[model samples]
Target chain A: MPDRANDPTDALRRVDLVLRVHDHQIVGPEGELLGNVDDVELAEVDGRWLVTGLMVGPAALSQRLPGKLGTWTHAVWSRLHPDREPTPVVVPMEHVTDIGSAVALDEWAARRLARTLGLELWLREFVVSRIPGAKGGSSDERPGDLVESASSEATEAAEGGSESEAALRPRPDGRPVSGLLGRTGLSPDGERLGRLRDLWALGGPRDGHPEPLRVTHLEFTSHRLGAELGYSADDRQGPALVRAFFRWLHRNDRVVPISALTGIDDTGRTVTVETTHMRHPFDQ
Target chain B: MKKFFAIALGILTAIGGFVDIGDLVTNGLVGARFGLSLGWVVVLGVVGICVFAEMSGRVAAVSGRGTFDLIRERLGPRVGLTNLVASMAVTLLTFTAEIGGIALALQLATNVNPYLWIPVVGAAVWIVLWRVKFSVVENVFGLAGLALIVFAVALWQLGPDWSDLWRQASRPLVPHDESHTTYFYYAVALFGAAMTPYEVFFFSSGGVEEHWTAKDLGVMRANVFVGFPLGGILSFAIAGSAAVVFQSQGIQVDTLGQIGLPVGMAMGQLGLALVLLGFFAATFGAACETGLSVGYSISQYLGWQWGKYVEPLRAARFHTVLLLSTIVGVGTLLTTVDPIMLTEYSVVFSAVALPLTYFPILVVANDRTYMGRHANGRLANTLGTFYLVVVGVAAVAAIPLMIITRAGQ
Candidate 1:
């Protein structure tokens, strides 16, 4: 079988991760419902920042929610956690096989992990399953050979990660894509440019598999009204009126390469970058 | 032959399923009070709904995502959640009104109190939602809803002066007795009833449930372009009949029976029976649609498994939402609030919530990433933009008009 990861036309290349991936539905290989890409885990490894995992569930989603709603969601999620310390469910990036209408995860991993959905499982066990016709037409039974091959492939993938490789892998600090969004962008001379609107990422083949997207550029925009409305890209044609409106709204947005970014200060919520490297986002 | 039957059935169901309690009450009330002067609003609304509904349906077919999914994707979490709450509240209100409508329809048939029938009607709706196949639920009530063609028949049987109705509709003049504010208020209500957000939610989500692809786009468009306008004719027939019977006499339409009274006066008990059946099927069908819409909006916004195509147990969260919404609808109805009044408020509020539901659909439909070569062409974009302005005006003006006119007195 051809490896989808190494396909030259992979969807992740030269894409805005927040626009295409964030808040997208996550599905199993056979398209069973799982969850969503509630938040994305980012880690700095070998001097490059790469997406490490896709976080799922309310614990991850709460951070992306605004202000009081975010705090309330976090409070409720923490109180309901079975463990003393609760962490959001993170699916390793390696398990993702495709990114299109949905983020498709590998078969065996998705099946096993679907059990971790707290609310779905609780409702299934207590409420829906008890209904007389609840199970009608549910084709949960899969062929044994398919399951066997999937499990073996999963094991091989797991065994391939040796202790030496683990040691080299950077721990995913609690920094999520949502944390960087809306942070003020500052020039080295302490001049405020704009707010961080989105991140641009590029995907490539590495280590015999497709590497997770590495963040390549930071987009800063003075106005945030049409951030994900697809009008920022010159190729997005639409009703001339709406397209023109959004284009004018985001005309001041700028993109600076990661090479120009000096530091991201989470405490102060600012990203300091070299001003010389910045350019208009729509400029080829 | 099979494809032909499918197209015919799709169009038939669309025509049948078009008029819900909102359309019935708003049109009946508007006809009796203002004559057919507000008919142009219905025309504007039908066109507006067609423009946006086609976009939403096309987006669902090509992108495999429903309306709320795209709403959240484009608007982000904060603004998306606000839209979700507003749209969901309106849909829930409509759902409650639909359930009450079913009870009132039954009251008309059995001459029993509608209050006693509310719980029973709620349970029946829930059972159908739980057990029936998606297509069956759509087809049976939708086809049964075709019994509403009696409104047109009764309108002909009444033998009203057609030119007078045409003159009233064409001139678009407010009657001397009615203030301009009240006249425009009913126009907004009529617009809201025609383009209720739940219809798009249900249509687009239903498209996803049926797994429509680019191949089915032809049939989908046929359903919208042909079925919905013909259904809009049924809306006009209801208004024309009410205008003939009650406008001359100055009797305001405040009850479902009174809305059907013109038919009874024209064609005796037989017309009354078909009208009652039409009332039951239309409201019951809409109850199912609105109930599913409530579930669809919340689940799609949250990215949970939704749709009746999945086994009930598999979509536990979606079904749980459906169950909770049903309970809430029944409880609200049990409070003995007038269903017709509830229907009035629901349509006006539907107008208030229109732009939030529609703007995202327009943006996503034009997005090449999702629609590819199928993105809006010049004609569609022109119509889409025109309606966006119309919808925005109605949305902004709906509340103040309601307050000023005291909900059309």
Candidate 2:
């Protein structure tokens, strides 16, 4: 992996922080609630975890709820959705806009994808589609219209799809990256470093790869919670007072380049990185 | 001619929708006690709001993002989170007060207990939010709130000594019995009541909801400039009426009924009826505004899509927040807390919470990357900077003074 110490475009947060986002409401492009982020699907490549999709249905909810409650909920959920797989409903990461107070999705596109999945079917049949003025009476320009066209486009593409092309492509050997964040990191010599706060990546296409983005660095903080973007490896251009304060607050934050990463545990939680190549958060 | 009518309509609605429960309660209470002494604060707050509202409105028009949408990008997550918490708390408190205010307005009509009206009012607010179009909600209430003009008419008809009212307004000081701390407390309250953070949040988000572009900037400015100051005058009329009738009688204004007593005394039953209708519209309209603002600020902060333009089910989380907020509002009011007293505290706390909303707006309005050519000009910067200092001082002083005065006891 390239060691760009001052990369500023790595603002994406870790998916293991899903615990904090468990009950958080998910909203769509039109500011509607799609659903809560029940669980995240992870894809691991080269011993590093990356979020591939989000699980957002009753199955996902059962995974988060603990003990008997979870089992009973799962039983009820399974009964209601007998054909539903026990696995969480998957929403590809591409649909997510941000991971703030609510996980926002691109409603027009997400709806098409979600329709293909069972979650939208459950939601429509159980809730929205049944409501008064739910179908098309609400607005002249309905978002449903967009969903209709997208589904049609999806059908045409499915008819024209070639499995041979996918077989010919070199897919990344990635593992699921769920629940791997917020774990402690240890130096090779067994000294405690800090907890994993967020993973920074060189987002977008890299070397003409069709992949979403490549993780470039792991940001660790001695502080309890994660650092904001201001604590990113190379984001120093904001108000002087704010930058100065955050700089001091996040003084102990360290950014380890992917090159310094020695290995990650099989669970993909605890990370081991060579301390020699590590840089201070403020190091230019 | 068509564009001209739109501008006129915008300004008229702006004026009609300006005053909320905060203004009615604070101005009336201050007028009865301080007798226009804190009047200048309303003017100061109006100018502050116009300056910031225009800036945020411009940012929304130019960037197609609400002020809070860009808040995290500019202020970073920590500060943005702090701002969101502070502003959201105050906005929620204001929402509760508006709901209570709606109940009180209804109680005036039905003579039923306001407590009984709380659930019904909450249901109505939820229904409107759940089903009503954004323009319909905004226009219906915005235009209906113009009935508050009766306050100004009643003020004129009551015909208090023009010179004496002028004398009280010109000489800005604590009256003999009131301490300087109490005087400043109410001043902050009046200031806060005029420039509630939710107003700008609502205004900017309303711009986003309405899909205002750069062309809408002119109409937005007209609304801010012409409409808001005129609305400030209406606030003054509310204060002036209280100053004339309640001040002389030494009866401190405590209830919504007392706030409208001067109108009834001046314009008979017909005028009083119109003013109450005005109260209902203003408070109910403001309830919707503040409730929507609560959702907007949170959704924008977290990057969740939020707006009433989408169906309730589509924006389920936003609607969920609104539903929960309505329940919380109803629950809070059912405690039978005096809505007037609640309104007073909410605005003073709103004074303390001002800097959180204003700072990001100033920062973003000046950012050339987001705003491009529409960034804050020299005049805007000068005025914005001036208000920043003023807002800072008020924010620092607000809580301390509130503690000292026991919330303007």
Query: Which candidate leads the pack in DockQ?
Result: 1
- For candidate 2, the per-residue lDDT at A33 reads 46
**Candidate topping TM-score:** 1
- For model 1, the DockQ equals 0.39
Clash pairs, candidate 1, are: none
For residues A1-284, what per-residue lDDT tens digits would candidate 1 score against the true structure?
12334322234357677887888888887767788788888888788888877888888889989888999999998897554555677777777777665777776558655645667766766677776666633266432333344335444434654332232222446478898999999998899889998888887333325457788999999999879877775345677888888778888889999889899897999999998878988785
Q: What tens-digit string does per-residue lDDT give for candidate 2 at B1-409?
A: 9999989889988999999999999999999998988888988999999999999999888766677766655444445667788888899999999999988888888899888899999999988877799988888898999999998999999988999888888888778988998988888888889989999999999998998988888899999999999989989999999999988879988999999989999999999889889999999999999999988887776545468776554454466677788889899988878888888889989989988888778766754434556766778877887888888899899999988888888
The 10-residue segment of model 2 chain A with minimum total lDDT is A1-10
- lDDT for each of the candidates? 0.85, 0.73
Q: Estimate each model's TM-score.
A: 0.93, 0.73
Which of the numbered candidates is closest to the native, going by highest lDDT? 1
Candidate 2, A1-284: lDDT as tens digits: 11123223223323223222333456666555454555555566565545565566656555545567667878887776534333345666665666543455665435543433333343434444444555332456564654455345545434544332122111244233334455677889987678766555534322322245456667677874325333343343334444455577677777687677777786756888888867775575
Q: How far is A234's C-alpha from truth in model 1 (Å)?
A: 4.1
